[model samples]
Target chain A: GAGVSQSPRYKVAKRGQDVALRCDPISGHVSLFWYQQALGQGPEFLTYFQNEAQLDKSGLPSDRFFAERPEGSVSTLKIQRTQQEDSAVYLCASSLRWTGGTEAFFGQGTRLTVV
Target chain B: SQQGEEDPQALSIQEGENATMNCSYKTSINNLQWYRQNSGRGLVHLILIRSNEREKHSGRLRVTLDTSKKSSSLLITASRAADTASYFCASPTQGAQKLVFGQGTRLTINP
Candidate 1:
């Protein structure tokens, strides 16, 4: 792929509904990350994956927010019992490696509106 | 959570004016990177400065890092209407692959 790609660019969910966002990282990328951006704020870290290994999930706001990269290529972020605070853009980024400080390419993101 | 903070929540400037935004972070970092974003969109990587490096330039963008002060500044020379966007600074956590971003500075270049 040309760059990181995310699916379902926009989503509207009612309170307590469950939603899953998908991300297809760039070809051969070894690192993937998830972030949440609220209106008028910067993106905040949610989770990170080194290949298929989930190395960091400290940034996930709660246990309801689960992310998995089972095959090391495509990933999924699932939010259960969505709340109004979940109304934000969910972004996915992939980088070449965890070291060397390489630049990460970002996807357009999925804007989730919890009504 | 956010680790850095960018000053001047929002700024409006005329086209061709130089736009400057500052970011301050706590704790030590190996590198700092700047990004830009349009309204309700993904971020675009701009420039990165390693801890050893003090300043770097890319096209019209100039980035300076003051590790001693734990602060960095981005200066966009000859700003254009197209440059209107939100700018954020991110620092990767030690031994971690994730980047922690700042609050961001929303810049508007009026034409």
Candidate 2:
């Protein structure tokens, strides 16, 4: 693909429900990242993957938030038992570099609204 | 968790004026990168400055990195209304694969 792509641009979920957001990064990109952005705020890191390896997930807000990149190309972010506070835009970014310090390409993002 | 902090949470300036924003990081970093975000477009990478480099330029964007102080600044010359957006600085964390981004500086260009 030309750029990072995310599915279901917007989502509306009831409290206690589970939601899954998907991301398809650029072809062969080595690094992928997920972030949560609240209204009127910057994107906050959620997790990072280096070719299917979940190197760091310390940024995940709680145990309810989970992410996976089994093939290193497509990633999914799943939130269980969504709460009102879980309403935010979920962003996915991919970079060519194996490590950090490289320019990253971002998807349009998925806006999740938990009611 | 966020390691970088961008000063002057919001900025407003005339279209033709210059706009500047600063970022400070808590830990040492090998490099720092800047990104811009707006309602029309998603996040876009602007520039990156290595620790060894003091300054770098990409068209009208000038980025300076001071490793000793663990800080960086972005300057936009002759800003335009289209340049209005939120800018963020990010640095490597938990090794070098992931980045910890700042809260960001919201820039508004008035015509």
Q: Pick the candidate with the highest DockQ.
A: 1
The 10-residue segment of model 2 chain A with minimum total lDDT is A95-104
Candidate 1 C-alpha lDDT tens digits along A3-46 = 99998999999999999999999999999999999888889899
Instruction: Name the regions of candidate 1 deviating beyond 4 angstroms.
Output: none
DockQ in order: 0.70, 0.68
Model 1 interface CAPRI class: medium
In the predicted model 1, the residue pairs found to clash are none
Full-model lDDT for every candidate: 0.93, 0.90
Q: Of all true interface contacts, what fraction is found in model 2? A: 0.71
| Global CA lDDT computed for model 2 | 0.90
lDDT of 1 by residue, B1-111 (tens): 787999988999999999999999997999999999988678899999999999999999999999999999999999999999999999988876689999999999999
Best by TM-score: 1
Query: What is the TM-score of each predicted model, taking all chains together?
Result: 0.98, 0.95
The DockQ for candidate 1, computed on C-alphas, is 0.70
Give a tens-digit lDDT track for model 2, residues A1-115.
7899998899999999999999999998989999898887778888889889998897899999999999878999999999999999999999886466678899999999999
